[model samples]
Target: MRFERCRMLFGDEDFEKIQSSKILILGIGGVGSYALDCLYRSGVTDITILDFDIYDESNRNRQIGSDAVGESKVDTLAYLYPGIKTINQRMDMAWVADFDFDPYDIVIDAADTTKVKIEVAKKCYKKLIMALGSAKRYDASKIEVASIWKTHGDALARKIRNELKKAKFDRNFLVVFSPEEDKCKEKGSCVAVTGAVGLTVCSEAIKRILK
Candidate 1:
């Protein structure tokens, strides 16, 4: 069980600590699907999801299952994993303001929406966002992070720029945006790139919680 090393970093007595952990996987598209794979493989068994998107032909480029074309993504995952928890509604932090979300050790935003990332950042203790450079989200010499207006490309960048104009974000907070290295546009959405970013998100989660 050398692979147990992944779980051991958390602590000696918490083999299933991750199993008990509550993770909110927002969006079940390219990044969310792969993010779930990383979390599940790493022994994170408890999860809550929020997504209302039905599988469509457009999703064929990158999604969990090709057969899932006509099914609800969240429902498909629930059916597939059986034990993983799921939420079938889209997130609207304001209207759903009263809903109680238990604190998460790390919140992964594969939702592909800037608004969702901002919502999770405001609600959760820590947040991770996946971004690819297809759109110029401002010019960041390095890929680590960019302020709301710092990014120039990608759809996420535009959305963030708009949000920042409203002055809602906290500059002091730690919000990490990971633009896929090869990017979906240039590299095309390979399971390789998606899987790597997924692994990166989970790796960041481990480092944040364990270190």
Candidate 2:
């Protein structure tokens, strides 16, 4: 049916894996929103999106649902994708502490906050795929998925590396990052880059699960 195109690439048995997989997406901004888009269309039937933030005018340039101001991101995605679960809560390391990650097969960290990314990397029991450094740059081709330690050039990646080191968690994690430097001093984001990173994160999650 709707997943015929996906089933063509991976046979019926493999395509079933995508449907059975449950993914936890931690943000619903520029990157996370696109991740949701790709995962849902790619046949991932089970997903729980978490984000307490509402759509804002400023996010119109890159984030999905930004057109609907004041709309809850969690609810927006659930409504758009239908049948998916959602958590309307502000997430940080503190929130994840009490959270049970048992039902998920993969956790995607698309949170813009550095601490939240660190928390996901440190505490998440399921395999994690995170987005890093998708801001400012317009070239979507620059983004790549690599081990966190092998990532460079992006300021966010450097910060995450340092924090993970301090926490003494040296385990290698896959991250979608861009080596292209930020175009300006101010924090900025664009849909081209963020969307690309989001797609890459979903692709990595699917590959890991199938393997």
Winning candidate number (lDDT): 2
Instruction: Give each model's whole-structure lDDT.
Output: 0.59, 0.86
lDDT of 2 by residue, 78-177 (tens): 8788988999999977898888877789999998789877887887734888888787898998887788999978788889899888988899888889
The residue ranges of model 2 lying beyond 4 angstroms of the native Cα positions read none
- lDDT (Cα) of model 2: 0.86
Give lDDT: candidate 2, residue 79.
78
Off by over 4 Å in 1: 1-11, 14-16, 93-96, 125-162, 171-190
